[model samples]
Target chain A: MIKVEWFYWLCGAIFIAVAALTFADGTNAKRYGSGAFWGLLGGAFIYSTFVVHKTAPASVLGLAVIMMALLVATGQLGRGDTTGPSRAEQEAGADRFGNRLFVPALTIPVVVIIFAVGLAKIHVGSEPLLEKSSETLIGLGVASIVAVIIGFVMLRPKSPLAPLSEGRRLLEAIGWAAVLPQMLATLGQLFVAAGVGKQVGRLTEHVLPSGSLFGGVLVYCVGMALFTIIMGNAFGAFPIMTAAIGYPVLVQHFHGNAAAVFAIGMLAGFCGTLCTPMAANFNIVPAALLEMKDKYGPIKAQIPTAIPLLACNVALMYFLAF
Target chain B: MLVLLGVLLVVIGFALRLNPLVVVTVAGIVTGFLGHLSVIAILNAFGNGFATSRSVTLFVLVLPVIGLIERFGLQEQGRRLIARLHALTTGRLLVLYLLIRQISSALGLASINGPAALVRPLIYPMAEGAAERRFGRAIPEAMREKVKGYSASADTVGQFFGEDIFVAIGSILLITGFVDTTYHLKLDALNVALWAIPTAICAYAIHGTRLFLLDRRLDRMAEAAGLTTRPDKADAQEAGR
Candidate 1:
């Protein structure tokens, strides 16, 4: 049997090796630096999980691997610098928005989230919601993939995003990364559904103070937000956190509105999207798409906005809810 | 057992990197199997989810329409319209949009697409065009990019602050239920929604002022960029004629 620690070490080694390979390629370096950055980031994350010991290291490593591969495969990092029209220059003509690679890239996380949520909902006999959600996500993924392929075919620029000769190669890279989160999230759901959450709940009840609804809500929201920042997607964090606090304390004992609380709480969690590097889709994609001088330009712009909003959400719960 | 199997299939399928559609379809099949329903039952669930969330689909459809409008002269016309009005600055334009976006969202019409779906395609382009008309070229790419960022930022702020004010929104309902159950406070969704209005108004006002200041800042940047060649009043009058 493979020990978890051994798996971590192996994954860590793989991530570092991949990072080295990416650095070697000049063309790959520019288009997909974010992916390499994430591979290293993932390694750090997996190592940290061992330190924290409160979370699953395998899932964290899994997601990081997927993100790393996707970024590389999609030519997000090492595409040759061809600084086209600036926003001002583009404003001169009609076709200023440029190639919308971010749109398809976005589908990766969205599909992962929907798949995770559907899996969670299914455990509760909300079979219909689960089935529908899965189908919708699948439909969206198919549409996006097909659109991107067709765009590549029709738009066909000379120094294309990927090597046309290696068309299958690009697809394999993206396809590998794309499937990971869905699997991990499902595993997470199963772990939670199969009574891991119940154990977590028991531990929390003994440790936390009684009659501390405020504390509960605070912990839950902050935990969700922080976890999302770490994980990059709130949906990934949702099942685990909700399984622990949301189901046991918030919904079951406290009688909070399950749907509203989860939805808004998740939104509150998404506020972390503005601050963290881990939420590469929100942080890194905009940078890659815009080619900003400062790598953290998107995050810098978002802080002024996200911090106050998080405070408001907390206050909203206290003032409005309580 | 069936539900368990369905869940397992979903987990394994995604792990294998199969097409997301294929993974999901398999998941749906597994779910239906567990529920002791046939293939038709699974298909119906898919239809039902779409039908229930039709509003979201409508929001998606609005994107192409906005794209088409921008394809015409809508954005340029908007910029020309604003440029002629001299009183309108970048900040003022964004602040106005923030208010509109917030108010609409608060009214439970959060379906109105912003930034990526609307502002990027329409509002930012027009604002840039207007800035160019007044300043006469030389706008930096960084500053222009900042404009796009700000446009998206405004939409996000407005949506985040305003949506809670609508009592009917899922967030408000959630808050009420939590309060009622935990502390036994007997709070109403309407109460939570109503209370959110003041906060929403405050958000609008605060964001609006920031937008105004942003306009001043952009104006300075424009001046620094040596884009201060305002169209002559006589020329404007001639153009008007």
Candidate 2:
């Protein structure tokens, strides 16, 4: 059976190659910082393979992560002067390629769907063809490779390295915010290990009033949203809020339906997902991707929607959960 | 309790606008120390989590394809397509995308659209194209910025609300697993997914209305910028047609 690790290695190779390209680009003002940052991230991916096999110590990987964070924290990373096909060329390509330009781009999702939904359960003599645990991620990795090959076939660049150079340009544009999601996920893990969730749960329990169903439900929904805002993900906040008030007070004391309460509760946390920059992939990364002047543009756009939706969640939980 | 200092640090750091990487690293270390872990143990925790979370950064792999198509005018093509449609106002286009994004995600094809894959390349350009068609000029930077926000918002709101309605999705599985294992409730994942429908409908209604309002907002901006002398008459004629 194929595993996700193979795809990770492929990804690592791409990053390392991009880093090398960055190092070679004489136009980049902070080439050393940019090179080391990408190079180190690439090494982490490659090193993860060994760490999984118990050969390399994970702490070493830990140290590498810190070094990387230091690089970003100290403002060492900078964008290179790499440019893509100019506007005139792009327009010419558009006129020449027309809608066919969409073909390679659209292939990504098509291939991912085919693998994730269509071929997830294929087997050879009862041995699964895909790694069941990470089928979606593996599908993404496969889809990316397939799309790149198609792009090469369709776009037919003069240089084989155009794809990497273009990708490096976009990645440099995103800069540190590109890695912020993973960093937040790491922080979530640290928060868990430190029993921070337990303390928060305790604090919530202490703060809640006794035996009022509305209070219980209200607090649980708000708590989920509040915690998610801080943690940057509902997944991190769910367990803590659930344990704090969701299970004991709402479900046990007030007799709310577990399915409705928890389901809507998780959605409530998503409202928080909209409001916070900590959910970097959802909030901050999009701004960077769009090259917006305001880094908080997406979050600001989302807050109007998030606040009302959060209120809707509260009302929905009250009316439907019971 | 002192370990909660990490959370405090995150809040203060963000408020003070420090480098998040620096803030997060410091907060994690301080939190671990308070929790009585050794320096090595803290490193191990950070490393272990970072390695496991590599999937989050898998988006990097798709960047090359995005970069390539973009270089070759994928966005320009999108703009041309929207321009040909003629009737697709900026608001109408986003609502259509939100509906498609939400429904497709509900059917478990959440990866079909994203900022890198679709929005930056296709949706935003198309939306902007529609706006340019409406105003008959280059949109002011502020209005262009608002369109960007809404375009990205459509994808996000659509994904967040729609993904939960699919039973096989992670949020449903997580809800069921947590409740069943912790409380011995034997909850059905379907019940959890079923409960998501009401909120899903509300999400569409609420956000869909905001998107509609976006069209009105754009028209008002166009009028204020003196881009249109007879904005209401033109809008009325367009609506009539």
Candidate 3:
């Protein structure tokens, strides 16, 4: 009885397919490097899920990380291909689809949200439709399937492989930014696991005006923003700031509303996203993509917006948290 | 202490602009070891964490579909649709998108559009079409760049402010989980979502103003440069080239 997890298998299948495509094409200068990179990751995923060799999972997983590390060390995972459709062809597509093109384009997010957030509390006999926890993650996968189906119906891609190949091209273009969230999050865990948060908390307490609620709130929000600006990710900054200043000072001593504090706290960090180049994905990438004369054009436009938003968030959190 | 050195590793690595993957892996290994996870254990954690959190990139699943759509002319359709609206200006277009993006993101649909997916193909072109309407030819690349900036920022503003309003969003969840686990304080996700409404509105109003004004600025700037809304190919050709 090999109980294979279908989801992992699907993802693993895609990775392996992409790896094969990379190897088959062999057009990119970094073709060998990227092919090996994807192949190893795909192999790790497939083996870990299917083999059910309980003892081997950890070591196998370890090897994948090492493989990735080597790829990074050797600079092997460079992108191979980036050619896309010309303007004439793309315009021709718009003429054909006309107004109907949005049908597929819009399907994904609508389906994702409905499945991710809509069915959270529903019961199917004994168990919930989704696990009470991890509903969002599971639902995201389902929504993707539904969207892909919708795409097939709407676009009627000439062949099934069309979408897979297109997916690979875009995935390669996105490259590391695709898995960035997971990578940064692991760092967050490490920070907490290593008590980085606790130490920051100590330093924060000493520097702050003692017993001042305003001080605490301001410090927490500002700290989160600053840290996120540095880290290039609000999610990464959340654990550290909460540990150092957010949780202990705002949530514990002052007994602020954790929901309001953190909800607004994260928004504050996003203001940093608008202001800093470190958040390349958000600020810099778009600027670079647009080929703006001022490289910081987006940031310049956003500063007025970010500052006002941050101020409002702080005031909102301060008043509401109590 | 020794554990805090992991922070230094991240800071230095990023400052040096090393490949982020390498930097984060090194930081993770150092932190894992310092935190007392064996090397093998750390690897297992990495593998599991990567697998589970892979949900964020589930947008990749949407990419192929998006690619196919783009291949077929979704962006061309977008421009065609925008062209039909005689009065549409660059600012108005961006402002409308900002509202739609924020509202959808509030509904937890941030992935509906992104730089590579939507802006490049659809939104930027529509905005450029509007700019072309005014400049009477191809807009100067500089004005084209401004339009692109506004188009991209709209998505960011919408997502950053709007996503938090969805109670089930990860940021809100992180907050709820932290409070319940550490302080034994139960918080309502709905309350967070509701409070987020005002901020969302404020963001819309604030950025919305800038976007609206951006069109006026573009028009004035174009005029300052002696450009016109009438498509004069001779002048346009010279300026564009």
Candidate 4:
């Protein structure tokens, strides 16, 4: 039975390789800090599940992971050299291969879709190819491996390790920002448990006049957009906003269509994504990469679009979600 | 009031520009403790939360593949391919890419044109090249910058509206999880994705027009402040090879 645990073990092994390479990277200034950061995360993954039961004590595991997060958060965890092939090499290869370079790139989603559906029904001697319940996640893991194989066959780099080294280099460049989603999700769960959602519900209820469904939907949509801008991620904002304004007001008070309400609510959040420096990857990074004089250039071009789109989401939810 | 501290911590932390990982960790720990959970219990919540959300970072798997692809010169090939196409202007090129990015993302192929993977290398260069050719010389820095900005926003606009249309994506799953857990409403993912279509269309119309207008701005810049000349090309031209 190919289950989720095996997938984690696979992930744990990859984290180990990341750690080993971090250790081996001689060019990094604070190599030990970088190595320990990845190494400790690798340990957490491997030992937390131990392929089945979590072998590590919760306190020990917690403290160690917390310490590592602290190290990463405090900016102590360093980065390795991220320089890759020079422009000359890149263009030379581009000249040789042309558009065929996309073959390896496109392999990923192709393999993922096939595995996601195919594995569920394929039988092996009166048994399915995968344990049936969580086929999607497992399929994703298998697809990644398949994509790697396709990459090797297509690219045929000078050495097999080229992929791993390049991968590690990119991973290290992303660094502390990489785990922001996981950390934010944890915070979201804590906020829910701490009754923050209830507080937000109360606050929104007081602010909006009672029993106005349109008012409730409008508040909810606008709040979601504004809050996503503040938080920098719509995913992080979704749980809290949904629990607070969305569930209590939009869904229950108005008895709105849950699907339309939440879907449009998240879209509203993306409008915020369009107009914020907080979404650095989308807005700021491109400005920087393009060598724009104004760092907020993307946000400027996007605000007009984001505002109208946000208004459309509000109006759409008010109409469709009912 | 104590429960609200977690919200306060996040706002203040982010506004203060603190490290996000630290801010969130502190918020989680503080909220857990105030909710009367013991330290071990808080840690346990942290552990389980991290464990369960492993799927969130599955993009890590494809990152290496993308890195390898880039290292093998995908971006340059894209640039070269763009240079060969004579009909593309800045506005038209960006709009075309926006469509491609959005449609592919809707199909759950978002990684194909991601910021690091596509925009920085392929999209920026191609857009720059088109703008350079349109202006009859190196475009002014300001115009080039706006072109880059629009290029970047194209990817963002594409994925934002596009991803939700694929019901299996994380945000859709998040909705399924939310509605099920919160309202006891068993909403189908496809329903949410279907409703998302109109909103996606609206986003496309709004952002696509902005991209299209960028061409006029490029023309204005070229006319007013003569194009900046660049020193290169003794290196090698496309057909010269």
lDDT (C-alpha, whole model) for all candidates: 0.49, 0.79, 0.70, 0.74
What is the per-residue lDDT of model 2 for residues A122-238, given as tens digits with 9 covering 90 to 100? 997888898864566667778788989999998898889888888887788878766665666667667767887678767866777765777778888888888778767676567
Best lDDT among the predictions, by candidate number: 2
Candidate 3: where are CA atoms >4 Å away? A1-5, A43-59, A116-118, A209-214, A231-236, A247-263, A280-293, A319-322, B35-38, B44-48, B51-54, B84-94, B101-198, B213-241
Per-model TM-score, in order, reads 0.45, 0.73, 0.78, 0.82
Using Cα atoms, each model's DockQ against the true complex is 0.05, 0.39, 0.35, 0.41
Candidate 1 yields a Cα-based lDDT of 0.49
Candidate 4 per-residue lDDT, tens place, B1-241, comes to: 6887888787777757678788788988988888888888788767755554555555566667767877878667755654454346668778887887788777656654567767777777877776775565556677777777788888889888998886446676566544553344656555676778999899889888988898777777877886643223521253155
Q: What is the interface RMSD of candidate 1, in Å?
A: 15.3
Q: Which one wins on TM-score? A: 4
Superior by DockQ: candidate 1 or candidate 2: 2
- Per-residue lDDT of candidate 2, residues B1-241 (tens digit): 8988887887677556677777878888998899998999999888876776666566678778888888888756655653554357789888878887787677554644578767897789888877876787667898999999998999899999998875545566566545543455666555577799998898899899999899899888988887853354574477468
DockQ of 3: 0.35
lDDT of 3 by residue, B121-172 (tens): 6778877877876676755777777787788888789888888875445566
Clashing pairs in 4: none
Error of 4 at A29 (Å): 2.2
lDDT (Cα, tens digit) per residue for candidate 3, span A152-245: 7877777888878878877788765555555655556556666777877777878899988888888877877887778776766776677777
TM-score of chain B of each: 0.59, 0.64, 0.66, 0.70
- lDDT: worst 10-residue window of model 3 chain A: A1-10
